[model samples]
Target: MTVKENFELAKKAYEKWDIDIDHVFAQLKQVPISIHCWQGDDIGGFEVNQSELSGGIEVTGDYPGKATTPEELRQDIEKALSLIPGKHRINLHAIYAETDGIAVERDELEPKHFEKWVQWAKKNGLGLDFNPTLFSHEKASSGLTLSHPDKEIRQFWIDHCIASRKIGEYFGKELGTPCLTNIWIPDGYKDTPSDRLTPRRRLKESLDEIYTVKLDEKFNIDAVESKVFGIGSESYVVGSHEFYYGYALKNDKLCLLDTGHYHPTEMVSNKISSMLLYSEKLALHVSRPVRWDSDHVVTLDDELKELALEIVRNDALNRVIIGLDFFDASINRVAAWTIGTRNMIKALMLGMLMPNEHLKQLQEDGNFTERLALLEEFKTYPFGAIWDYYCETMGVPERENWLNDVKQYEKEVLSHRE
Candidate 1:
């Protein structure tokens, strides 16, 4: 049988449990996954002519064809988006501003700096998201920004964050979509600090100052991201998960959960339901981590599937904002984006295709045996057929066919980059 015939058979099988395959397809197509622009440039922004990475962040391996300019990065992103099957948004870091060959400090950034980006996003029919580049600058070399002891330095970072929120609002107003402005600072100690409370207090005060001006939520939303520890912050990280969770709840802002920002034993999937209970909305930075916070490319792993399942099962698709957050400079950048994004979409589709209501009913009735058996049976369902149908209907290449397009782009576009 052909792919469509197989999909029809699978659809009929799922109908036994009252699952609507067409509804799942319609919902999946409407979900927008924000693709991180840093992936195309290996997290090196266009703010300066730098040779090394800073702010306790590291990108290993010397991959060829890394995007060096804004135009190159956009070109690469267009190619990757062409192969992926969904409407999506682009997540931007503050350091990516096009300054017109003039030196523009972070604190002095204006909406006009990103006018080119706004135009580009409009032309491509993509929405925009923003982040404060709290690291990789001289101000952040001391392993602190908003939490720094020096009032001058802390105020500088606060001003930068405030500027970023304005830029985010501008993007949203221009593109007619709410842009999420996330603040993630790399501030901590290499050794245990006796004055931990001082830094946290400073951070709280700095955040208050940054958020003093309330922007309309229709144009922009604020989010705070946390990290367990970074390279130089192994001993202590001021903005840990608890800190952001409390801050977000108190301030009525969204808390962002980066998948690689936790201990090896902890899974972000388990935290989603709990977070949704307190916060009105939540943001996610999905990435694959091997043992530690190494920003590896995403794949169809068990945790990825579980994360997607939790979102679908809880009916929180509209409340949760999803974005990709990995940078693997060891391979082709365009292919990396295509692979990670396609796998993410695939994982979400798998979760949506599950008989979640039936499983919940079985669990509630204490029919553990049947629930386990049916779940195992679900593993063997023709999910691939439905996925292929999704790609075909969305007008994107199915499965391995996307790789051929990536390879072709590498030869025609990426390989020419010096």
Candidate 2:
């Protein structure tokens, strides 16, 4: 299969999906979903991270345990790849900071370590891409100390972050250019209220420095992972308006949005609409809800689930990279991970099936509210029914000669890209 052939094969599957949505919905009821990452590391040949996935298991996002070694992870990926049929892939939730002496598997931010866990992509036939994580790649600092508000301490924090930036650079240079190097900082403080607008100001200062002196293309996937909180007195970006920080920074960098970080009072769709208002600043990091915590998966909630799909309906979905941000140590890793991936795909497929009239309404509308209201009307429709129908009816199973087919497809796609 050529790249075109592979894509065509996928399109055929999707078209069948479009035609048999009702059938798909019925099948969903009949079939038990077989997802990746279940309880026990080796139960289903999953790479489990027990410490990382500690939480209530059945639903919330959590890791199970160390399922496999790099080799094992690769084998499982191949096995799973053999199962998946041209599905769009996102990432697993938060990858932790490394250990003390591991050989910084990826040498970008060396004196660091690399987990074989992330290596699954290489062996399993997947390509790496970007997801929102990093905000400012500054050097180390205590970050806005007033008593010691001297430039020295603040510089420390900036340098600390910049070290991470070095790691990012290393990734691009050494790791075949990571999909994107993401960062989220714990710099926001709240005790004395140093200032409301400092985080962005400091971030901008750091990024400008990296661009001029450190790396060239501004981190390629430069992004800000924001949250509304404080440690000593520094208030973070409190609302969508503060997104100006991202806009100010965004010639090439992205202002990524985290669904889990949104205030509980806010509607998920409203936040989606709000981000579109600042579309230049808004990149995406996706997950579902476990009450208050970010579950890092597609779930039963109609709002987030529907909102996740809505981005595709408006054609803005691709403006960002997607990743599930869940982490629990007790859950079955494969099952949970698969749920997130499967449902994320499902939600995305939903928004794509919106009517032409609806798309036109959104595209042509002068008023944001009206366009949103129009899109809001079909919340109940099985937007993904068509896609589900296609996959379920056709089956997610690999064809008998799938290895050869995938080899041919990979060869063609790689050839075209290079």
Candidate 3:
């Protein structure tokens, strides 16, 4: 059957619940997921002097055709964007800066280093986000940056973050959308720390200094991300959730909650409502975590659905800046991006299609039996039909047709890469 034919049948089922199918499509189109560029290159950014991946994060597998240059990375991003439905933004790190073979220190980075990126973004009509690459650098060798006891070391990272914010501001001004500049550092102790307070205190002081050179909020939005634990810092992390939560609340910064940054039992979906209550805006780094904080490709799992439901039911679509953060070098890089991003959009669509108000009323009225029944029944609904229609309308290949494009591109473009 035609994609539109299947969609019509699915539409009738959803209309019974008083859901606006057209409105859902429109809303889904408007929601932009910030796709991380590092996924294309396994977090190996283009720098004259590059360092090995460290700071508790590791990208396993040697996927051939990984982007080795700025132009190639952008090209790979364009390829992935072509397969995914809807317009999205690109997230970049400080290490992606192009200095024309000149070794530019992180603190000395300027907007000129990212001019090509801004131009590329402008050409594609895409928004851009920025991050200060605090890991994989000589200064971060001690697993301490911005929280180091040495004032000079902390100052270096402070300057880098300040510089990154300015670059984000530049992106916002160029793209006409406020750029989210997030700061995530890998500063923690491998074993139990006798002086946790001291490192946290230093981190606080360093952040204070970074924000001192204030730029226009209309251009750059600031965010701070925290991790429960990491490869090296299993015992204690300086930027704990409690630390960044309080810091973000008191300082008026957006707290970015990474899905993989929590313990095995703790879910980020449960934290969304509470976070939105206090902050005007929050951000997310949507990923899948295995036994630990392993950055696995996101799937349309139960937690993903719940996370989307939380954002949709709470009516915080605009309030929450959704972004993708995962790297899997095992599969085709472009396919990895396509799979993870499409699942994210699919999760959002599922949330919109749900009878959230009805379910809420049912719960409020103590109709738990009916609520559970409906929830379970809706899982078998024609969700795939609706998703295929979305892809058709968006002019992207429907269903696994996208995989064919990836395979063709692999043979034609990616395989040629040395």
Candidate 4:
């Protein structure tokens, strides 16, 4: 709704209800927001801060058809900022890429090379969001067929993280502000008999080494991008909802939601609802779908998209961190970032956005009402109309573009009045 329209609604509602309607108006102030640089096409290597949005691209992982270089990772983030240059900056929290040596490994980011990334971020103005995968991709290196069983594999990863911390060491200390370190281990299940691995307890212990350090220091929490999957179509540990819920309760750390991870099935909104039940202990994010694929391109999937927003609203939460969760080998970070952002908005359908039961609880917990307003804002989106009746059980926005499309709507209403 426009500023004037919003005020008018409040006036009408307040006259009838006698509620301090303006009490809910969120102060127009900068809120600490973050976006992951998994997509390089539109928003790679760039920092989006309330102050200035510019930074280097952050690319990672070794994919079959994907190709994103350090330069691309550097450029994407830089461009995202330049696209919306202004004061009160929108800082880049960090560069997030996997640990595939083929794309990015500590060795790939040699001392000087690492400095270049940092310097670029500093120059362009952004922070870092490190993923545990940034250290190694033995799985990918081994052709994504064999799992590394050598202690060196795990130890090497630990060492790389320590090194990253040393390199990332900032504020005269090790680590950066709003720093993010993610560890998504054998997060899936095994399919065959020959595939041997450590127990979940030991695996958690291994990841805990780093988690302990940060938690002890009370540093930035490393979000666990949990998923339920298996190798060769076999299920994995963190792949199922049961495992994820168990892990969240046991780990006592933040969990990141990857929308597409539960692809092919599962209600994204329902999952969001469950997670928010444990807010302050978790975070939310999205990645585009690839193929019948575990994680692929992020095109608009009707059921999935509607469900995702409902999940957000159901959880009644805001300040949710969004990122490119696409792990396709064919696409680069820039393409990933752009597609990710576009998908975020395109997921919404227009009409009167309203909070549901889940939102009410979220509001009660968050001590805020922006969740209500956000739903209303979504109503003005162009896509809402077509989807308005798609599933009327839940309220959605009417279809109308905020600009040109809305004008036509206005004329129709005026003509009927005359």
Number of the predicted model whose lDDT against the real structure is largest: 3
User: Model 3 Cα displacement at 232 (Å)?
Assistant: 0.8
How badly does each model clash, as a count of residue pairs?
0, 62, 0, 72
lDDT of 3 by residue, 1-418 (tens): 8999999999999999999999999999999999999999999898899999989998988878999999889999999999999999999999999999999999999999999999999999999999999999989999999999888888899999999999999999989999999999999988999999989999999999999988899999999999999998999999999999999999999999999999988999999999898999999999999988888999999999999999999999999999999999999999999999999999999999999999999999999999999999999999999999999999999999999999999999899999
TM-score of each: 0.98, 0.59, 0.99, 0.58
Off by over 4 Å in 3: none
Model 2, CA-based lDDT: 0.43
State in Å the error of residue 195, model 4: 8.1
Q: Write the per-residue lDDT of candidate 1 for residues 1-418, one digit (tens) a residue.
A: 8778878888888788787988998999889999999999989899854535777777887878899999999999999999999899999999899999888899999999999999999999999999999888888889899999899999899999999999999998999999999999999999988887889998999999999989989999999999998789998999999999999999998999999999988999999999888877899999998988888999999999999999999999999999999998899999899999999999898898788988999999999999999899999888888888888888999869988888888888888889
lDDT (CA) per prediction: 0.91, 0.43, 0.95, 0.42
* Higher-scoring candidate on TM-score, 2 or 3: 3
For TM-score, candidate 1 versus 2, the one ahead is 1
- Lowest lDDT sum, 10 consecutive residues, model 1, at 48-57
Q: List the residue pairs that clash in candidate 3.
A: none
Q: How much does candidate 1 score in TM-score?
A: 0.98
